[model samples]
Target: MKLREEDLMDILVGATILGCGGGGSLEEGWKLIKRELKKGRKFRLVDVDDVPNDKIVASPYYVGSLGGNSKDNLAVKSFILLEEFIGEKFFGVVSTEMGGHNTAAALTTAAELGLPLIDADMAGRAVPELHHSVYYIRGYNMCPFSVVTAYEDKIIFSRTRDDLHAEKLVRSIVKVTGANVGVTSHPIRGKIFKRTIIRNAISLAMDIGKSVRKAKEEDKNWVLSLLELGGFLLFKGECVYMERREGSGFTIGEFELQVIEFYLKMRT
Candidate 1:
């Protein structure tokens, strides 16, 4: 019960705050994680040092879709599909991608599997695609990986030597799944994890969230504290105009935001 309901809610809200306006919504991600938790399940966290050297590691998380009308709580079924497709007992580290929702999703899987979850991640920051991970650049395998789509709960099992191919396959499946399929990839060895993974990412995120909470509770500046934690300065602007549409699973568009006497272009 280390990750209680209140803890999950705090983490979700804190992550959205930490997201700095670009990470996925806390509400959607929280509902997904909470729904799975309510199934009377348990989750655990493990330090990277506890993992074995040669054991396999993988990350299962939500992929596809951005913004409104995204995927929801059915992601648990995806995990079940993944286990069915692997058809073998897995013993290794479990990690996350980078979004607030993905981070929670990874932890939820670890909790359900009774596996020692690693605090690291493939991407130090959340990106729009799968292959954009340090694991992809480090030559990790993406097969023996599991993906659950929306078609009658059928799981797609993929094994690829190249991570990009795996990403492409996942994207294609997402298109078929209505742009929001759950996926797991970048199977790697535990011993070499330190080399390819972004160390302490989960814990780092947790710590960041905690700091923000403490700052807010103490009537201090959350923004300043958050910025000191790793957030980069994007810009300051007022919403003047915007347009967007989903194209190939991405909400492609541009926004015109006025900032004093300056303007900036942001993709929404």
Candidate 2:
């Protein structure tokens, strides 16, 4: 499927909902799409099967806070650098996680560079840490990693003994860069990617987005649309209070939604 300009809206919304509140921001996602579309760039969407086993794939994503200055095309730069370092061409770009910004990382870079965007992603949903990656769970090594910042600074790790060490390395790099950086790694075979990736997850996200829009058009509860997809609606209410703590290159936070009566209480 070719990603058209308008598809950005539904895709972003769907990815955000899939994020479950931990995914990258919707605004940042739209910004990347709009910027690329305005530049007349085009991107092709392909399933895992579309890419051959011998083909190389790179998953690109931001490794820092979404609110930071991440508008730079560092991920794309990293991809280019990786190709030069490996002395080979990358066949496609992939999303590390399904989120507004994370999804855009692959799409925007693929579109701009004329590479295919893999239909599946490393993580089916947005997660707070790199250790949450499906690739790590599936026994893929997080190595030959590349990191880039807006300053055009670049670092590549030939290999990491483990994913935990890889995540720690990324956090340390982000701190040293003093800005959010783009990361892409594991230039593995498409066949390996097919085995590890959450297949057709992007298509599911697109469908969910469309359903949510249709539900709104019908004046129905949109959350029910997600419930149909094995998702539970935990609660529905306005946020009353929100707090967050920033440390160790991460922000942790919690919030309370004001919903009275008929509410089930659980201790955290």
What is every candidate's alpha-carbon RMSD to the true fold? 4.6, 3.1
Collision pairs in model 2: none
Error of 2 at 88 (Å): 1.2
Which residue segments of model 2 deviate by more than 4 Å?
A: 258-268
Clashes of each: 3, 0
CA error at residue 134 for candidate 1, angstroms: 0.9
Candidate 1's TM-score: 0.80
What is the TM-score of candidate 2?
Answer: 0.91
lDDT of 1 by residue, 96-215 (tens): 555567666776666666765676777766677667777667766566666666564555656565666777777777666675766666566677776678877666667677777788
Quickly count the clashes in candidate 2: 0
